[model samples]
Target chain A: MEKRYLDYIDDVVSRIDTDSQTKNKIKQSLTEHIEALIEKHGSLAYNKLDPVEKVAWEFSENLQLQDRKEYSYPWPRRYPVWRRVSQKKIFNIPLYHITDGYNPETGEFEIARGIFAFGPVALGVFTAGGIALGVFSFAGISAGVLLALGGLSLSALASLGGAAVAGLFAAGGMAVSFGLSIGGFAVGHIAIGGEVFGEYIYKTTTGEGNAVEWFRNYLPYFVKFFQ
Target chain B: MITIEIRKELKSGVIELAILALLVRREMYGYELSQKILDLSSGQIEVKEGTLYPILYRLEERGIITSRWQAPLGRGKPRKYYYVTGKGRQYFAGYRKEWNVVVEFMCKILE
Candidate 1:
């Protein structure tokens, strides 16, 4: 029976491509439902039934499928589904990729909702902007150093803020309030270290090359390491 | 004799678990799982492929189960076969225990 349950779990898992977080949600939900099912229907022999037969019986009773392409929910009963259209629809201007935003009345952004609508395009732009800011800090003179450092700090804060915002979209609740506040400060320190390193690069003889050239040499290394 | 409301409630709660538990027994693919569930239920349960995939994916994510791409055995598209994990065993154990307790509690009340 234990083996059977494990096999059952494997079969279900094979059918979907859910991420770890969503998987956890499914697990919790399944645990509850499984318990409920077992309460309602128990051992096959004791109940004069087969386990496989009993399980299938209960499943058919509960699970449902709706084929929207074949059928639509009758009007006035439509649920607000998170429809995925291209970010191009919202702003209609090239390079303006804002998809989801906070309710204007609430005056607070919901990070999770934005992530859903914006998808990877918005996230990529935000991340690239942060990396650019971090890299530029190193190509500075003494006065430029201070400004670069400040910029780096701000960038880090913004990146962290962005991450929390993204997570909020993923998590969907008050988890954002606490996460953003602490994440904001942590980003500041990251900028400080990144700036100091940038200064060293500027002073070093290796700083002769253009920023693009330097990145061209180093970007592959970073990608390889991450991979 | 369960009412429609009771049936709906049961479906929401137990259907996924039931499908998952059945697959744990052997290496039956999607169609087999669907057919088995239907047969067992005396046609009381019927699972379409679309609804089945979402539930299967949700199970896969937890590391409780894993899958492999397999050549077509009999009919339809090339299928992904699933197998249970150590974590799934432990999880099912907990599920079984809790289920027993609930059943016992319910039986006592009904009696």
Candidate 2:
């Protein structure tokens, strides 16, 4: 009985970080809690309890975690925010998750991962949030493997934002790409803007700035895409 | 039930709030704290047994609560007792106001 209980305690401790001192301290506290449990259960029935049966409550379908008014994850306008996760999954990631809040202890925002993730910080196949990363993304600041749309965005294929950067195409107030770009300040192989810099640059309203070169690795893929 | 999933979902985070509230009243060890929650709430705040440790550890880690072992003046085993820190009291004061507002709104809305 003791051994099985110790094994359960070990399982819990293993989930915590690998600091020996912290682990030992946590182990001591956990053992005391367990002893308290035993005292309540009467040591005879203590071994009958299962911890796994106890833990599924955290992830069950009906779980709702509401954040304080100060937190608005994907957007910055709300008093309270909540996240609901779908049951479906891809690569063990949730199908859709809308979660955003900073951990009080870690002070890091909760990361939302899903095919369609929306939160303060999100990663998914299609993501939209404050800080987004995905194959297709839209946010205040975002990176997209295929296409990005937001205030500031970086994309492998195309980017559209106030300030945009891409390998193939970019269109924004300040746009930079390897292939084609159109913006107020544009830089690309074929650039069109008030102030432009590239192998071929066109001035529209008339502006001037020193040419700044860029280094890129995805230019070959872009050449293939254009071809 | 409109409340099953709601209760379960609301349990974990609010558990911390409840702990701080109870500790503000008086210090208690793990078992006592758990039992009082059940009794006061008419068993609604049914904590998954033994899960209190992790929450207590988290509270301690954040400096919201502290603990010390107390022996019954040379009789039985020493039990670790927990009490709220000054920081916890201040935090609870703010949290209590928030909860009060929330509760008032929820009551009006649900009614």
Which candidate number would show the highest DockQ if scored against the true structure? 2
Off-target runs (Cα >4 Å) in candidate 1 are A1-78, A82-84, A87-227, B1-9, B48-51, B74-76
Q: Where does candidate 2 stray beyond 4 Å?
A: A15-22, A52-227, B1-9, B49-51, B73-75
lDDT for model 1, on a 0 to 1 scale? 0.38
Clashing pairs in 2: A64-B9, A69-A79, A73-A120, A74-A119, A74-A120
Root-mean-square deviation (CA) per prediction: 20.3, 13.3
Question: How far does residue A209 in candidate 1 sit from its true spot (Å)?
Answer: 66
Cα distance off (Å), candidate 1, residue A143: 38
lDDT of 1 by residue, A32-137 (tens): 3343334445644123222533343233222221223113333222222222322343344223322232221222332222211232112322222222222212
The lDDT per prediction is: 0.38, 0.71
Scored by TM-score, the top model is 2
Clashes of each: 14, 5
Across A1-227, the per-residue lDDT of candidate 2 in tens digits comes to: 37867877776554332235655765786677677676567665456445532332221111221232224334453312345566688889889987654432233467878999898888998999999999999999999999999999999999999999999999999999999898999999978788788886656664332222222233344333221
Candidate 2 chain B: minimum summed lDDT over ten consecutive residues — where? B1-10
